[model samples]
Target chain A: MSLHHQIRQYLLDQAQMHGWLAHAKIPSERELQTKFHASRITIRDGLTKLESQGFIYRVNRKGWFISPPRLLWDPCHRVNFYQQARDQGMQPETEVVSVNPLYDAPLIRHQFGMDYGNNLELLRLRRLDGRPVMVERIYLRQTDFPGLAQQPLDGSITELFANKYQVQINHESSHILVCGTQSEEAALLGIPEGTACLHIERKRYDANDRLVDYNLEYWRQDALELKVSSRK
Target chain B: MSLHHQIRQYLLDQAQMHGWLAHAKIPSERELQTKFHASRITIRDGLTKLESQGFIYRVNRKGWFISPPRLLWDPCHRVNFYQQARDQGMQPETEVVSVNPLYDAPLIRHQFGMDYGNNLELLRLRRLDGRPVMVERIYLRQTDFPGLAQQPLDGSITELFANKYQVQINHESSHILVCGTQSEEAALLGIPEGTACLHIERKRYDANDRLVDYNLEYWRQDALELKVSSRK
Candidate 1:
């Protein structure tokens, strides 16, 4: 095998072995060059191959780090996303990036049952164990919650709905696909612009069959593992 | 906006309007340069951005073509994938690429109820509307199906098992993730190696609750739209 191929395999084996893995940074290109006596280009080629394969990611100045196992998601789980992560022994965090109001939004207006085409959007940045995982934009009508803007934003919206407003999620429909990150999302996720991402679009309904929520979530491609029962 | 951005938006508007799109080849870089009086780099930058955003794709010898909408997939659908695609007004095609035998595969042994670890693997390439969409690898134990090698390979395995073998899929568990395509899968799907893809791992059960089938499907990221209800 070529030197670059050898380097790729060696790094893969290092990652597969728990001893050398973790979100830990691998050797720098200079370090690898000195250790392996290979050209800088060769080392770079190996690292680029690894990055494209989703085994590692580079943070602008921080160099490269081993990617963690994707967070497993089961659509049948009855809890919210954060709780689900916690159940898997992961520390999940959610921050309210921004909250704004939308009026006369034509495309999304029909998705809701409200007579008026007015809605509130909550932008959230979420992390798993300190690594940026997802950025979610949640949309809902302001008329549904008169004082929603006054409520705390950093907490779980699901829990807040149940405890504060006597609301619960009955059922929801979702669409998942692969897409590229735009500038805003790229900045939040710490990935490059146009990086491949897992895009999820969801709509939640209440007992009365009212469209209670609509959400768009963009996740780092390596951070999501989706498990579904069936959808023809 | 810069000339390249203008070129990108023009192509996007053309595709979204559905007037000039239909998988038809867009102008070549040289043609685009003449038409827009822009540098070759400018034309390429626009096309590159569109490709990265999943708006278009290129064949090896052919030029760029607009990408179609993702095929919708629902995990709760009662029918098989091909049937579902048919219902959506798409011409689905399946081809048997290869089949092989395996022995002493320890990793997969316990996933089946069979006492022995010997199994057979069926490799298939599936297309939608003449576009290669997925490459599937199916694994099963030979002891479960006598004379399985003689069975027709191109048709639906789900249908074949039901009609010829009296085996029906009762329930299945599946995992989905965003991954990079390997060389074999990339070759079959006509995509570059390390391209982002949607990876699905599924295990199907029979009426008797035995693991009857194990399948791994690699799909072009732009070709799949997955819908799941909940797993949290």
Candidate 2:
């Protein structure tokens, strides 16, 4: 491998081990040249390649910094979270936070397709790897999944849909993008108020056109990445 | 039409005539009952429906305000600006801000697929729905369209691609979300500094795996809405 590629890999390994994903200003070109024992041109070549790949960026006078790649989600596909992570070569993990019945709220009323007075249920959590990157609040229709709160939901909700409910989520449409974390959201994602987060408000329905699940996934901007390979 | 629909349309028409998107708060339930000569429940129901559909969102102590739906561009599809606007039932218009050839900047060099020494031509603009919504800075590879700088690029670049270079951009990937308007971006978007704006970064390519266009579209947050329908 080339010297620049070697240095790039070394830095990437360090980042992976330390679990740092946000942009970081590293040593200047002169310092990198002396430390990596490479020419300035080679260092620039490596930095430029990393920037193009959405791994790092130069901020005017501030030398170079690591950057998380943008995450590309195809609204056309209804793939689950774990599947989406695996496709991107990431280790997908989950932990249960809370599962409780929702009572007399607008959110629950809408999720359960219940009458104005009917009840609903919710599962909220701080989903993460080594660090919490997202807070997922899922509202499930109680009529469709009775006793779901009593079952083990720490694993895959997709698997639950298939094996337990015998339902197949063939398609889903998501409204996905970024937003400044609100006070409540910030606390859950373990970030400062006004930190950037990728918010995915998704509606998962069954084959019969019933609203089965609604999810709000707040992903930490620093810890996630996505790419798009468009079809012609 | 129902009284609520009449009121909604009245608000919308007023918004259009004033050439702005936001509106004064609606009369309180008591006031609405008197003005519309309807029950408070009816007025509340109408407001609730609109809020659910994202036509409006609450602002804590402040009452309801008209919300323009955001434009959700699917990165998987090769949809152009005009098509995106048309889908939202809005008339999209553009004014050419400036078109010039540039070179030497690393960012420009990377975007236009230019050699370190090559020149790139840019077409800048403030786009609108009969009123300004965004300012776009578009960079083109001069190698692909040698005489592009001399053409009338005031119209859609997609048309220019077809006519000048015989290239049809079949797919585009975009990063679309809210961002605080930087000083320079604010000046271009005609908004105050720190105002929220939608920053859309896109890379367009043709059918043969060749990068053809690059665009940065910065839109005022209050100026647009995004809607996506997904089936599960």
Candidate 3:
């Protein structure tokens, strides 16, 4: 094996033996170069190989760190994001990117069984333990929940719909697809363009069997573990 | 946009407007070169871009073809592979790669509540409409179903277990992860190395709720659409 490959193997062994926790910063490139008696480029090549293999990740302007274990997601449950992350012992946060009245969104209209100009579009960024994991765009019929746009948009929208509007989401139908990430999604997730992502579209209905929300979520592939159980 | 990008956009427009069906062969490189009045290199580059975007794929000795629409899979149903594909209007076939008695498979033993040297391993390749889509490795307890290795093993193993052993799979717990495809997986699926694929691990239980099988499936990302419905 080449020297850099040998160095990569050594570092990988260290990671395994030291129980390097997720997101824990590894030794700097200079430190690795010094220890391995290699040049900067050789050390960099090794790290790059590791990153591409999902063993590590680099944050811009920050040092390299171990990639975190994926978050387990149970789609069959109605638990909101906050509760789900907390249950898994991870800190979760949501930021409202934007909310506006959607016009002429044909797909959303068709999903909600509504005409154009009747839905409010909400875009939010969701993070787990301070790492961006998903970007969600939700469209809801404006008449379904009055004054919804004026309310605080952070935290669980599901809880808000249930508590304030007394509209419980009774059912959800989700479609999951794997596709290349768009530039906008890559920007939001801080990943390169053309990275693979899980694109999930969900149609949510209330107790009356009326479509209340249409949601589109793009998740970082490395950040989630989806779980489902089926019984007959 | 660059010349190749413009060509890519033009081809994409044709794909959208012409109603090019899935798996339908697009024009050849020579034809594209003549039609677009572009250099051969530019045309090749454009096609390469489209392939990487999952808009198209190349079959060795055959020309480039449009990717098929994703197969919608609902895990709630206990339908076997053949039945599921047939229900979706696609032909499904399975090839048994190999089957052997497993020894010292700690994970399989733990999952099946068995000691070491008690499991049988079956490797199978699944194809949809004559195209390779998934590779499955199933580990089952040898004591649970004797003489399974000597069976035909071409069709559904679930059916075999039901007919011969009267073992009905009652429940399935699945874990879904998205990661770069391994070398062996890429070769089986006939895709480039490191392509994104959905890795699903399922633990199946019999009617008495005993763990009967542990299955690992690697699905080509572009060929599947997973669906789930949640109810309160």
Candidate 4:
């Protein structure tokens, strides 16, 4: 085996044995180089390998740190963002980016089985513990919920719908794909372009089986873990 | 907006209106350039933008083609490999890369509540319609199903377990994350290193609520779409 590979294995063993907590800083490259008696390039290669494998991440010049524990989410549960984060012992915050009336959006019209009028679009940026993790774009049919555009758009939409509109979300159909983040999303999340992300498209329905909202969520890849329990 | 952006929008409109089927070849670069009276660089830039958005892909010397329709998969469904592929109108094939007895797998032993000495590892490469889609690594306890390592490793392990040991999987717990593909998995899937992929870790249990197997699956990003239905 190569020197870097051997060094990587050693670091991995150390991480496992010491129970290196999330966000803990690993040894500096210089320290690792001196300890292994290896060249700078070898040490860098080893660290890069570890980073790509999800063991560590670099924060510009801040050096390498153990990756944070991913937020465990169960999409099947009707829990809102606030409850989900609180359940995992993390602070959650939401910033409403923009809210505008949309007209003549063919896709949104088709999804809600309406034609060309009275739609509201809401864009929000969500963070966990002050780290931006997801960007959400939601479209709602205005005719179904009069004056929805006037309501405060921050915080949990699910709770807002239930409290004000008395519309309980009964079902959700979601599709998930992995892709490179676009420039706009990258800028919002403070990540580089082409960073891998999970793109989720969902159609939410009310208790009457009406398509109430269509949502698109772009999530940072390393920050979340989607959990599902299957029954046979 | 830039000229390339305008051109990309026009092409997108065309794709949606004309029902451009998946895997169909789009107009060549020369054709696009001539039609738009644009330079080679401008046309290439627009095409590259589309490719990165998952609208199309390049096949080396074969030019660009529309990306194939992603296979819609519901992980909660108790469907085997063969049934899942056929349900999506595709052929499925599996090759057993290797199988061996594992004695000192600390994690596996801990999960199965065993000390050591009786574990089996199986590695498989799976394809849909002749295109590599996923690589799976499964670890099973030998004491639970004696002679498991000696059984035929090809085809569906779900069926094999039923017929050989009468062990029906009753529940599965899964965790999903998105990350850049590793070198070994990239090579097997015929994709470039560091390509985005969905990594799923699953724990399978039998009717008695005993842990039976642990599996890790790496799936190509563009080849599959995970679907989930949440009921409230």
- After best superposition, candidate 2 residue A133: deviation in angstroms? 3.0
True-structure lDDT of candidate 3: 0.79
User: Highest DockQ, which number?
Assistant: 1
Predicted structure 4: clash tally? 0
Please identify which of the two predictions, 3 or 4, would achieve the higher lDDT against the true structure.
3
lDDT tens digits, residue span B40-128, model 1: 86676667556656777766567888888778887555467778888787889998899888876777666775466579989999998
Q: lDDT, candidate 2, residue B191? A: 43
Candidates 2 and 4 compared by DockQ, better number: 4
Full ranking by TM-score: 1, 3, 4, 2
Point out where model 2 deviates above 4 Å. A1-93, A103-120, A127-130, A177-184, A190-197, A206-210, A220-230, B1-69, B72-91, B111-119, B127-132, B163-165, B176-183, B191-197, B221-232
Per-residue lDDT of A98-172 in model 4, one digit per residue for the tens?
888887678777887834467888889998877778888999877767887688888788888889988888899
What is the lDDT for B9 in model 1? Answer: 80
Cα lDDT tens digits for candidate 2, B60-131 = 345666655565666454467788878777777777767766745678677655344454646465554444
Report the poorest 10 consecutive residues by lDDT, candidate 3 chain B.
B45-54
Name the candidate, 2 or 3, with the larger lDDT value.
Answer: 3
Is candidate 2 or 4 superior in lDDT?
4
Which parts of model 3 are misplaced by more than 4 Å?
A1-11, A17-20, A24-53, A58-65, A114-117, B1-10, B14-21, B24-53, B58-65, B115-117
Q: lDDT of each model, Cα atoms only?
A: 0.80, 0.62, 0.79, 0.77
lDDT of 2 by residue, A69-105 (tens): 4444454544566677667655566767667667657
Task: Report residue A124 deviation for candidate 3 (angstroms).
Answer: 0.3
Q: Estimate, for each residue in B23-126, the C-alpha lDDT of model 4 and write its tens digit.
A: 66788889998888988867876665455456666554567777777778888875777887788788889988888788677877788774355788888999
Which candidate number would show the highest TM-score if scored against the true structure? Answer: 1
